[model samples]
Target: MTHRPLPRPLNFAAVFLAAALTVELLDELVDGATGAAWPLVRQDLSLSYVELGLLLGLPGILVNLVEPFLGLLADLGYRRALILGGGVLFAASLALFAVAGGFWPLLAALVLFYPASGAFVSLTQAALMDAEPARREQNMASWALAGSVGNVVGPLLIGLAVTLGLGWRAVFALLAVSTVVALIGVRKSPSLSQEAPTGEKLDWRDAARGVVAALRRGEVRASLALLECANLTGDVFRSFVALYFVDAVGATPAAAGLAVAVLTGVGLVGDVLVLPLLERVPGVRYLRASAWVTAIVFPAFLLIPHLGAKLALLGLLGMLNSGWYAVLQARLYASLPERSGTVMALGSVAGMVSGAVLLGLGAIAQHFGVEAALWLLLAGPLALLVGLPRRASLGSR
Candidate 1:
């Protein structure tokens, strides 16, 4: 029998970009809005900084726990269902968050929301990978760019909404509408059907074994460790940067929101500019240079005391930081065989674990000061350097 080549990867960039933007809108509505309103929320709710951190961190914990199961389901050929279902659940969570009156209600909503987000993210990447296995690097770069665009747009939109006196609840409502629209976009896209078939049923135990086997490989392990470090740094900044601006830099809520918007917007630009250049550069060399740049720029946030100087530093940080995800993700895809869903899910799990640890550290640093928290950010790049071997042979093409 003559074998036909697979269809070229679906040009789901528009769908993916729309969905990613919606997801970011929801995320910013919940986290970014809350961060900007931290002072007001703390005063109104009579909550401590530690409690706020816990509330924010809960999503990470829930998402990590549920991701492996979602990944298993995707591998079992339910990619479309998982993606669509996640979108629905994410929308509902945002609605719940908008009306949530107390801490418990907010926490419950987050628990529902984040797992769905994780599922959607994993399945979306899997779908893209299935569509164009040969062009995995380019596609993954595009995927990262979509996320960067979302991050940029989400914060700026929410900031505008808040500035217009729409309040945080209104922001959530807008985000819910955006998610529904994105869901429609996703449904219109062609269904993906390139996953490996599971001849017999496989349990979580089987999946766990697969994960263990993958991690046991030396190069894969190194890559995972490096990714964990990157994740920790990113999560730490995302979770606390707004608070730092408000409390440490003496900025108002609107100003803090603008700072975040600027960072994300510049980062989006960086992703678009960097994607085309990846092919011309050696992946290993690019990773090394990006890592060093991140390491240097991240700590500089500590020294810049003036608001304008800090914003400038953040833009530079955004430029360097934005490319890291695409580079790392491309390397990750190159390292794995065909288990894109499984690999991406496992990577998410690693990132969540790192997020939880970083949040704990953030809580501790909150007691001391944001300065100490900045120090914690330094640990990530240092860890990345230590975990990654000096030799470049370990990374896959």
Candidate 2:
């Protein structure tokens, strides 16, 4: 009898990719759980929409001051250190969120969480893009896929906690534990310690100069603008959907949670399909067409009266916007080339505008109600339709 073939050894590159992707998965899991739990958090803290706005927007504004610096440091070959340190803070912030008794405490936790996530999660993403320079779009699609899966799971976890009578706090506490495991995986990734592309031990001042230079590029500026505008349909939309279901659709808390899951679950399917689709079509071409369709679909989602009809439209909206982030983000990395960390820095700068938009949306929701505030989300598709290049030649498929 012939001997059996030997088992394959571990591929370090694949292992590193998995570890990096896990960080993104956990980050989105936290976001999904938070969005799904907003109603419960609101009731427990007795927070007004304005306070909710502050919680979401102010921390982001504050984090911008820190994240740009962190991004610079990452470009200077400090990525592994920054990621590891940020992971510790990320875990602590989740622990704080679990025990927060009121709005101020919750705000404090989120304030800490934002910059921590920028360092822990965003830097890791940059490292992944840097690892596979030629495959930036494809890798970004994979990243989005991992995040979409997290989005689906996060709401289900909230539902499970509520069903078990453990509550939203329990969900965050569990997330804290899971984050530690992800940190361990990242710590073991050998690829993370590589030097910057220049291979020089540069100072922060040099990194700062690099960021300044990156900002001067028109393509970089356009990408950053598109990213912020596109976000109106993403986390910004997610933050309000469950609340909208509760207030406007008159769904029960359980059903509202289900609404969040359904939206994200369909999005996960879209993310999956977009991976292969990106190889066949220029991402920008796909984006322009999707934007036009989303413009129509979003209004119908709001005007539709029946819950079933709204959910169907929500699923359609999710599918239509599938590769939005991955494509735009990949374009940003392409613009910057090997300077992925600089891309993170520029993105953080752009995120300030998004923070302001969230604050404005909150104020609008407080006065006119969530239904009116939701109309602001139409800006996402509109921005893409206006901003995406008319010809696909700007980026080869």
Candidate 3:
């Protein structure tokens, strides 16, 4: 009897990729849940507006100072320690959030969670890239897909908690448990121990210099620019889409909220669809085409008077740009091969600069109106058009 060969068990590499992608998903899930739960948290803690602002902004700024060094440390052969240790701290921080009595305690937990996420979640991403160098773009598409799922699931979890009359604390407590489960998966994964050689060990100072050298390179600088610019059409656009619907389109708050949902929900569908598309299309070629199409569609989205038409354009824009980050980031890693950790370090520094740009955009919005400010997002696809290499295809690995 020619029985089908027994279904093969997952090999080490496959198991490791699963664990790493789970971490990415969990990371975004926590972020989505936390953002959704914040109003409840603020009411429970009786937080002041200033405190809310601090909670939103302070931890990110503080973590930036340390995450770059953490990235350097990962390159210095501390990836496993950073990821596992950070996972423990991440769970503890969530537990802290579950029980925070006031703003200060909650702030402390936020402070801890940011860098811990950098260590556990971001390093897991780096590890995944190292695990399969030839398949970086493909693997990143999967990672991005996992994150998209997490983002969708997170808000749903909060909604479920609210429906059941369970408090936000319960949601956080559950997340902490999930974090532990993901940590165990990472800890058991054999691939965490393996790293591409990074030459002789250098002290943190030397590693910092290495990051500086990478920034000096034209390709690295361009990659950083592309990443930040891409955010304009991505997270930056999501942040303001609801407001745009309200202020620009004269939509009610309920309808505005639906705008946000459509943006994210459609983006999630795009992420799912992009995985198969990437197998057939070269990443760069697809990005170049996406950029040109988005450049046209975004302006139309702004000019179109009809709300339905605008929504259609927005969904098309989201779908068109689905593989943007996956492809761009894989190219960034390819540009600085064997230095995935350094890529992280560079990303952190670039992030700080990009964070300031958001403020500038906000200032422009306040002065010129959101629609005018959103025009700046045109820079995203335009940047891609300008910066992407002229080559038609990178050819499959």
Q: How much lDDT does each candidate structure score?
A: 0.68, 0.86, 0.87
In candidate 1, position 215 carries an lDDT of 79
A best-first ranking of the candidates according to their lDDT comes to 3, 2, 1
Give candidate 3 regions above 4 Å deviation. 1-9, 194-199, 392-397
Which candidate's TM-score is highest?
A: 3
lDDT of 2: 0.86
Candidate 3: residue 311 Cα off by (Å): 1.3
Please estimate how well model 1 matches the true structure, expressed as its whole-model Cα lDDT: 0.68
Residue 328 of model 1, lDDT score: 63
Most lDDT-accurate candidate: 3
Rank candidates by TM-score, best first. Answer: 3, 2, 1
Clashing pairs in 3: none
**Alpha-carbon RMSD to native, per candidate:** 5.0, 3.9, 2.2
Every model's TM-score: 0.77, 0.84, 0.95
Taking the tens digit of each residue's C-alpha lDDT, what string does model 2 give over 1-397?
Answer: 9976544223655676788889999999999899879999999879999999899778977899988888888888888899999999999999999999999899999999999999999988887877776667778888999998887789889999999999999999999999999999899876676576676777888888888987888888898889888888877998899999999889888888778777778888999999889888888889998999999999999999899999889888878878899888988987876677788888877777777888899899999999999998998899999988987643447
* Candidate 1 off by > 4 Å: 1-54, 101-105, 162-166, 188-191, 197-205, 238-262, 295-311, 363-373, 382-397
lDDT of 3 by residue, 184-253 (tens): 8899875665353655666777777878898899988998899888888998888889889999889999
With a 3 Å backbone cut-off (N, CA, C), the pairs that clash in candidate 2 are none
lDDT for model 3 comes to 0.87
